[model samples]
Structures are given as structure tokens and as C-alpha cells.
Target: MPTLTSHLTSHPQTAEAYTRATQSAFLSLAGQGRLPRPVLSQWLSQDRLYAQAYVRFIGGLLARLRLPVAKAADAVEWRVLRVLKDALDGIVRELAFFEDTAARYGLDLAAGPGEASENSSAGFGPNRVTEAYVDLFDSFGARHGGAQAASVAGGERTLLEGLVLLWATEKVYLDAWTYAREQGAGREGGKTGEDLDGGALRREFIPNWTSEEFKGFVDEIQGCLDEYAAAQGGEGVQDRALELWKHVLQLEEGFWPHVNLQDVASTM
Candidate 1:
């Protein structure tokens, strides 16, 4: 059975986008501990905002999944629901991780430019890329029936699309972080040498991201998406997944440039 993962990999453009994202300079420099503190602080702040939105995104998806499916009592549906529940729990832990990271790095959680504006798309301050990503997730949630909505509107198709987006986002994140970990390990053409002390990023952040537990969560997300995509087989499904895969890559690529410390400093 061809999973959505297989289908996505079949698309050359999708594969290329994923490759580019994994190999991006942001990840490379971040792993090497070469990014300035201000830049990393800015990036982490934006990510914390994104993480908050992601909790809502997963909540919305869980709400959609709870609606009665055509196969009401299917074990697969139950399994997916359990997976989503576990993922929500995991996000809670992830949020705590971000909070700890911020504290350790002395990053002000509320320091970003848009923090004062409650009207911003993201309730927290968000850079443009973060705002755009939040809007995309919000639109999907609104279209499919938001977290508090009593009835799901867009149905299975919407659920599938949301799942694709979730999977793609996690996939890119895992790959990018894994790439960073590898680079930090001195595997990428001697980027991090043995002589220098491995900085907090290499010793702390990379380990947190590349841990076995985190890898397991990433795998669980991938499996859930693959199972759902395989069950919802059709020509249109692959196309939709591919489209979402590319969109996620584009969003991720756009996010890195916003972390440029030099650019941020130049404006100030």
C-alpha cells in the first residue's frame, strides 16, 4: 500500500523542497553555534509563538477526528484518536522545553515587535512568517470547524488536508533538527571541531531535538499520516498531499530569513 509519504517522495519538486529546507544555512549555522545570541533569541521567541498556535491546531484536529466517521467503530479511527491525544500531550511537554530554553538563554518571551498588538493574527508577538503560518493553520481550523465548534463542517477531506499539513510540518522540523544535530556532531566537513567547547546549542538544544523520545514522536506522527492517507486513497489525495508538502517547505524556508541577526540589528 502506497502511503502519503511514498506519494510525496514520488514528486520531484516536493523532494527537492524538503532537501533544500533540511540543508538550509539557518540550520547549518544554528548547529555550528555560529548564529549570534540575538538572532537565536529572536528565532526562539517566534518559535514559542508558533508552538502556542500549534497546540490549538492539534486541538482543532482532534475535535474534527472525534466526529463520527463512516466506519463508526473502526479500530483505526480509535488508534488515530489515541495518537492525536498523545501528540497533544507531547506538545505540552514541548512547550515546557521552550520555556526552559528561553529562561536559560535569557530571552524575553515577550520581546518581539508585535507583542503589544492584541489584534495580531497570533495572539503572541509574531514575525511575518510566523503570522502567515498561524493564519494558514487558523484558516484550516475555521474551515473545518474550530476547536470549540460543535459540528465539523468540511468533513473527511478537511481532516485529511489538516493531517497532511501536520505531518509535513513535523517532517520538516525533524529533518531540519536532525541535520543540525549531525552538523553539530562534526560530521559535516568539520563544522564543529573537538578543540572548542561545544556551546549550549550543541550540548543542549541539539540533544533535546535529536533525542530518542523526540524521534519516536516524529515517527508516530508520520505513521498516523501515512495510515490516514492510505485509507483515503484517490488520485486527488496525492495531489493534495504534495501541494501541502511544498507549501510547508516554503513556509519553513521563509521562516529562517526572519532570524537574520544582522538584518534585525541594521533596522535598529
Candidate 2:
């Protein structure tokens, strides 16, 4: 049987969505250097907010971990905690990167949803999709589900679930940028990534997103997730993993500068 990640990527239900999330029209246009500046700004702005929520999401997972008393060699908790810490560090750096890139490119970090074109609707601050993403993050927090029963802890948004989420997001992101790096404006002729998309995308963003270090981080998280899944083997685990995988893929597919998600932005 395939690993969970491989299974999700290949499963008929998730395969198309995974492809859409990684090889989207938005990314394709970006690869071709034909993406409009305003469209890019809109996505960038929403992404900044998403990154902010990610910090809290990782923190929640860190807090929920119940490390064993003994400091066993290479304990799963230690590995999981380290990855979460790395996630925090990475996100902090990303926020700063966002600030620098936005200023350098004169792109508005607060660009409204659907602000891509004049005909598209515009709204202030975070869009519906962004808020929805945040909601999902908050749902995994230690305090989620209100009742706070010990039983509920493992029932709703367990540590395994949150870890899976973290892995899924990072996995999708790495693959998405890998796609960009291969065919983005950075390719072709003697063009360097810095030479295209005002240096924000092909150059800065794609390189950062597709870096070997980032790949290592993603791999570590995947190992951690798989380890936890195996250690926590039980009924409903696979079902929950599959459910969250599909959910994240769907959200990712919507997160792009997508026409199908225009209503999500407009309705907000």
C-alpha cells in the first residue's frame, strides 16, 4: 500500500484537486509571466494573513503534545516539538519576507479580495477563504470543542489530525512552488528568477518556497506525521486522515486566484 501522502495524491477524489492546487491557472500564468500585478497582490495579501494564522495553528499543536516523562532517544514528541518550533521560526521569517517583498515591489499587503480587476468585487481586509482557513486553524487549538473533556481531546482535532494538517499544507505548498520553479517566468532563455514578476514571485517567492531547506522541513514533518499515524494506529484514524487531506486540498484549490472562489471573496 502507498504511504498516506502518496495515497492522497493518487486517490481519484483528491488527485484532481491536488493537481489543481499545485498546477493552477494562477500559477501557470505566473509561469508565463502573464499574470496581472493586481491579481498577484490580492493573492499575496491573503497569503500574508494565512501565514499569520499558521503561527497559531502550529502553537496549538505544540501545546497539545503530551511528551513522555523519560527523555527517550529521538522520541516522537521531541521530533514533533522540534518541527513545530521550526514551523514557528519559518513563519516568522516568512512574515518578514512578506513585509520586505511588499515594500520592495510596492505591492499592497492589504489589497482587497477580488481586487485583481476593475470588474471583480473588492472588499477590505481578509477574504472569506482566508477567514475560513483561520477558522480551521482555530478548530485544532487545545481549547477547541468547548466541553474540554478528556475523551473529546482525542475525538476532535487530535494531535495526529493537527500534525497531518501541518504536513498537508506544507506538502501542497512545496509541490506548488516546485511546479512554478520548473516552468515559471524564471525559466526560458537566460532569464533569472529575479528578472521576472517584479522580482516578487519567480525570484524571491519561488526560490524561498522551493528551497532545499524548505523541502527538508516538509520531509521532516511528513516523517513526523507518518510516525504518529503509525504509533496511534486504531479505527477511524485512516478515515480521519483521508477526510482532512481532502479538506486541505479543497481549501488549497480555493486559496489561489481562482474564479470558482470569486463568490467566496465577493460574498464576504
- Largest TM-score belongs to which candidate? 2
Error of 1 at 158 (Å): 1.3
Off by over 4 Å in 2: 115-122, 146-155, 185-187, 190-196, 259-268
Model 2, 26: alpha-carbon shift in Å? 0.3
TM-score of each: 0.78, 0.86
Worst 10 residues of 2 by lDDT: 259-268
Error of 1 at 248 (Å): 0.2
* Alpha-carbon lDDT, every model: 0.68, 0.75
TM-score of 2: 0.86
Candidate 1, which segments miss by more than 4 Å at Cα?
67-74, 113-124, 142-157, 187-198, 258-268
Residue-level lDDT of model 2, residues 26-95, one tens digit each, is: 7765654445566778889889989998988888888799888977958888888888999999999999
